[model samples]
Structures are given as structure tokens and as C-alpha cells.
Target: MILDAKQNEKPAKLTIKFNTDKGTIYLEVPCDIPDYGLQESIEKIIEAKCILDNNSNEGLNDLYIVEDKSGNLSIMTLTEYINYRKSIRQDILLLFNHD
Candidate 1:
């Protein structure tokens, strides 16, 4: 298999913004997040954190994901993007621990 220059470079990361009247959240996410359904995963995180957000962070329509590279966008509301981070971190740990 051969990959062209465009394909070789990973698609631009998706930026998850939790914009709200109170404040805003800015997060950059890798486009090719392995084994993780982007929208669904984010929704789960948001639902999980609904209770944790005692102060009501997410506004009526303030959470969305934007891809600068390809101009793709998705809407979701996750209080914390922990699942993705944990999955990627765990993978990294295993990769480096192989000694």
C-alpha cells in the first residue's frame, strides 16, 4: 500500500469547544482517534458529567467540535474529554513499556 503526501499527514485535529455564557472550553482532539466513536464518545462523557456540573457549564447550544483542516464540524457536550485522553494515554504507556 502506498500513501500520498496528503494521506501521510494525519488530518488536522478536531477542536472541541465548550462555549457557554459563563465561560468556554477549548480542546484539540486528534482526527484518527482509534476505536473511539467521536460523537458518541463525546456524548457519553457529557452525560456522565451532567451531574458533576453543579454550576451548569454547558449552555443551551454551546458545545461543538470543529475541524480546521477539512472544515468539518460536529456538535456535542462533554464536560470532560477524559475517555479519549485515557485511551490514548494507556496506549502510549503500553507502547513505551515494551522492554
Candidate 2:
């Protein structure tokens, strides 16, 4: 079975909604990430954006509550997001590899 060019294309945009004291902040960026690396790539983009946007060192070390399009939430510090991704990957692997 062969998929058409349109069928082979993934969504090019990612929308990350951030709720702040000021109100909701929406970040829409180009995303061409593959399925296996999607979460990790999103986290990395968030971490970089947060670091660039924050004014203070303390803000750089803050924890973020990220919500997905489906309303699922995850809480993790910017510095620890990669580690969190690894743990999630391990859990997925264990689930699939279990006897």
C-alpha cells in the first residue's frame, strides 16, 4: 500500500499554550518532529524558549506545568525535562518488553 504525498505529511505546526499570571500565552512554532522523538523535542523547545524569555536566574530554574492539546498535563523543571523524557521512554520500553 502506498500513501500519497499529502498522506505522508505530518502537521507542520505545534501549539503550546502557557497559562501565566498575565493570561494565556500561546506559542506556535514549526514542528516537523518524528513520532518517536516528539515529546523530547517539544520539551527541548520549551526549555530553550523559557530560558530565553525569563529575566532572572531563579526563573530559569522553575518548574513548568505543560498541558497538551488533549488536556493532559505534565509538571517538570526545565533542567529536568530531558531526564523526565528518558524515564518515560524507559517505562514505555519496560511495558512493551515485559513477559
Candidate 3:
């Protein structure tokens, strides 16, 4: 069912998947982010993951990005993510120059 949130409200179940060294990991991302904002959202998630896992997402280029349309899933590339970041006025260099 389509549950519409109030204006400026956010979803509560935003999630993404990633293939890690050991296995697949499902991450809970924050809601209220537009499609174009996914790039930064994912970076934030990965940054948190890096802190928790004590490793960088250096080679993890592909992301199982969940779109805003009816929970549809898509495997987004780094280029696509950067483009999306550009659309949302986020820093694109973070995708590559992360420490």
C-alpha cells in the first residue's frame, strides 16, 4: 500500500544492500531523502559502516540502491551516484577522495 507521509516527512524503512568480504549486509538508511540525495545518504551510511567495521569501502563501487518509486531496487554505479549527488548539490569528490 502507498502510505504518503506529510509534507517534509520521511519514510521509516529505507534500506540498502551491499556485498561485503564475508557476506551481504543490509543497512538501514535515513528516510526523507529524495532520489537525488541518495548519493550523500549512501556515503553517510558507508562512512558509518567504515567506523563500525573499521575498514574503508574502497572497492565497494556497486550499491543496491533503493529508489523512491514503490520500493524498486537498482544497482547504481559510482558515476550514477556522483551524478545524483550533483543534482542534489552535494560534494561529488567525497565519492572518490574519502579517507
Candidate 4:
């Protein structure tokens, strides 16, 4: 999973994405103000969602939540999730182009 943030005139846009064997999941969030407070809140919300969905006991650090399992698994916020999905799509396109 990955999380990315962009700043615009109107609001701050955040996207989250994850890759799974089934496919991908994404989430996007737009905030009126791009402040640390808002960012922290958003991160917490995303962490909670990830915990609930994955049924894992983990904690959030920086922009992502670390899975305590013995795997390179990471969860992202909703917004980050969306951006990650987009990134994956772009990678697929690049791969096909090279082929």
C-alpha cells in the first residue's frame, strides 16, 4: 500500500491504494485545508479501517500502517489507496508498452 498527497488551490487531495491477489482497492479523500492536524486525523481513520478490514493488530507510522506479520504488507489511507491503484495501472501500461 501507499499514500500520496497533493496540494491544490481549493483543497488537499489524498489518495490511497493497495494491491492484492484479487486485484486492487483504492480510496480518495479531499480536504479543505492541508494541515498536519487534518493529515493526522485522516491517517488515524485509515489505520482504523485497515485494522478492521485486515483483522490484524498493527500500528500506524508516518504515512502508513505496518503489519506485524512476517510479510512485506502495508496498508494505506483511503486517499493513498486510490493513488496506489492509479500507480499500479500506470505500471501495467508501462509494462505492456515495453512488451
- The candidate that wins on TM-score is 2
Q: CA lDDT, every prediction? A: 0.48, 0.53, 0.51, 0.49
Look at candidate 3 and tell me the lDDT of residue 21: 55
- Please give the distance, in angstroms, between residue 23's alpha carbon in candidate 4 and its true position after superposition: 22
Runs with alpha carbons beyond 4 Å of true place in candidate 2: 1-55, 58-64, 67-74
* Candidate 3 global TM-score: 0.30
Candidate 2: RMSD over Cα atoms?
10.6
RMSD in Å for candidate 1, one decimal?
A: 9.6
Q: C-alpha displacement of 35 in model 1, angstroms?
A: 28
Q: Write the per-residue lDDT of candidate 3 for residues 1-99, one digit (tens) a residue.
A: 225443443347666676655334454445665785676566655654454355355655344343433443333545665575465454435643685
Q: How does model 4 score by TM-score?
A: 0.31
Give the Å shift of residue 79 in candidate 3.
2.2
Per-residue alpha-carbon lDDT of candidate 4 for residues 1-99, written as tens digits (9 for 90 to 100): 234344323435465655443334443444443486456555655555555556443432223433213422355644565576687688867986998
Q: 75, model 3: CA deviation in Å?
A: 1.0
Better of 2 and 4 by TM-score: 2
Q: Any residue pairs clashing in model 1, and if so which?
A: none
In candidate 3, what residue range of length 10 has the lowest lDDT sum? 1-10
* Count: clashes, candidate 2: 0
lDDT at 53, model 1? 49
Judged by lDDT, which candidate is best? 2
lDDT of 3: 0.51
| lDDT per residue as tens, model 1, 1-99 | 334455653345666555544444454566675554566556644643453344553453333343323434333344323444566678867976995
Residue range 23-45, candidate 2, lDDT tens digits? 33344444654574567546755
